[model samples]
Target: MTDRLPYWRLSGFYLFYFALLGATAPFFGLYFAHLGFSPERIGELLAIPMLMRCVAPNLWGWLGDVSGRRLAIVRFGALCTLLSFALIFVERSFAWLALVMALHAFFWHAVLPQFEVITLAHLREQAARYSQLRLWGSVGFILAVSGLGMLFERLGMQAWPWAIVAIMSGILLASLWVPNAQPEARSDRRARGGFIRQLRQPGVLAFFACVALMQLSHGPYYTFMSIHLEALGYGRGVIGLLWSLGVLAEILLFMVMSKVLARFSLRAILSASFVIAVVRWLLLGHLADELAILLLAQLMHAATFGAFHVASIHFIQRSFAAGQQGQGQALYATLSGIGGALGALYAGYSWTRLGPSWTFALASLAALVAAVIIATRLSEERA
Candidate 1:
């Protein structure tokens, strides 16, 4: 709530960055489909960037922490993401697209984990206020999804790359606006624990496992939900609205996240998200033609992403030392990338061989396993 916080600038970075996600996540599969790539090929295309995330974040994050140049790193990554993605205009062939995906994602995924540390450093002790700023990213996502959906409905996915490039340009500009924020200094004795040692803590390990499982469960949704909806006879405009609806729900959740965090344990919040995810995927897979059920399932994004994400970031803030925050966030990003890559690969093959129903059912199973892990292993003592 301090006047000194670069609220708009920080929020702007998330806005444009997730704006990019809004364009890519909901529409990319459709774009590839237009190019006549098979479901398995589309999944492989999607997996490349996610696989890059497993390495890129850690490499960039280590440099940021070591150099104390986190903002510089963000700026560099944003610039590279734009430059590499521009190559999309040149080729649509599988090998060509794969190279584009790999190059752009390497630099693209590097930015967020470092930026998370930057945002947290700025928030300082009032980390609860994070939801207020992060909500703008949801707004950006909503705008991107709905607007691009309409544009695609009218003009087609041929123009999708242009929209994405524009969003990435915004991310580049926003990165320049955000000021660097160093982590608050702490006592020598308190900062003494090693990063690997923190990783070994039971709660920390369990949290990582549960989060990876959760992201793994999201593969089908991220990779093919739009394609699935299209196959079911929904038009681009309607599909866009459906995607926006989920993010709208996420924005509402974020608006009250501070209050929610004040009242609930992270374990409870994450547990609820996993349980809801189980239902959400099932509803998505089995009830595609039921608009009411689809709407309800979309709303579950409030728990699936909003609650789970805010809670996870807070957990990292508390668990890691000031010096290790960058790596901590990177590790989280790395694991998420790994899970997402595996999920995309599995979902792709499943969709082609077993169909969408089985693909989403597998996602539900992953969420169910995550829920069980949280209930059994994650410490209830965390707030």
Candidate 2:
């Protein structure tokens, strides 16, 4: 198994999958705004896909576990994601956009968590190596954001859908090539029997709660940072550079993640991530026009996303037995979904009512609360 990692196949899937994310996440809201959607309406539109995350991963995970056909699910999900997104060219009405977002995301959200399990299965004992492969995702994101940022600068957001369609098509094709693999065995009968008992364990719920809150704080950034910068008078090309810069920070951190994981406890990493996130949000909210400060804040993506994600996934890998990995990953995605949906909905309302400054202040508060929860409730183990 170690000798047969299928490195390019797995990495290609991640590259193209996140490439699709790169095209959409940074520019999608801007496109919607160009089409005359208000902040609240755009928020509603963005939230639909996140709302799908609440159910899609678990449903697909169940199918994979029951049928032992994880790759089949990935291929099907990718194809459907492409098909649903292709409909965007036919209409731009708010209702049509909402339906498309939900339709595409239902399958899109399922691919990653299940693929994470497959990747970990392939890595077996060398779990730290997971970052090496996953970093290509950050690279893909950087390429998409930076390149498309420049393209959209000249051609306008009207070109956005075509870029996304091309990337989504790439994802569908890549999914067809990844070979299926199973996680290694474990002796926990509870995975097959008492699933509820696993949920009630020490730190599990607390960890998930913290993760949800962290993502909730990201609502404004994920949904509106591009628009936010544009409102601050930055060009789309610069906006793309800012977005790519954040992912670039994440990519660099991933390069060193194995060393960082070996040295620091997961508790330390998570706690620091939450704390830094609080500062990052505050800076983005109040100091966005200051290029130096904005750059500094974006670099904090290393802590906010890079460290937080690596730690959380490692924690999940350690906590769940082999048979339960699917459900565990699904729960993570679901909780993240719930947080993201609420965050987007709240940010939508808040951006109109509270304005960007206070809205981001609220986001900082969310991260602070998450940090406090982690400090007190979570253990200091080196997961």
lDDT of 2 at 305: 90
lDDT by residue (1-383, candidate 2, tens digit) is 26688888888888998887789889989999999999999999988988998999889877776776777888888888889989998888888888899999999988898898998888888899888888888889999999999999899889998899899888888888888899877666546554457777778899999888998999999999999999999999999999999999999999999999989888889999999999999999999999999999999998999889888889988887787788888889998999999889999999989999998999999999999999888888823
Model 2 Cα shift for residue 180 (angstroms): 1.4
Each prediction's total of clashing residue pairs, residues at least 3 apart in sequence or on different chains, is 0, 0
Candidate 1 lDDT by residue in tens digits, 1-383? 89879999999999999998999999989999999999999999999998998999899978988988999999999999999999998977999999999999999988999999999999998899999999999999999999999999899889999999999999999999898899986863325668888888778898998878998999999999999998889999999999999999999999999999889888899999999999999999999889999999999999999999999999988888888888999989988999899999999999989988999999999999999999888887642
- The lDDT leader among the candidates is 1
Best candidate, TM-score: 1
User: Global lDDT of each model?
Assistant: 0.92, 0.89
- What are the TM-scores, per candidate, against the unseen true structure? 0.98, 0.97
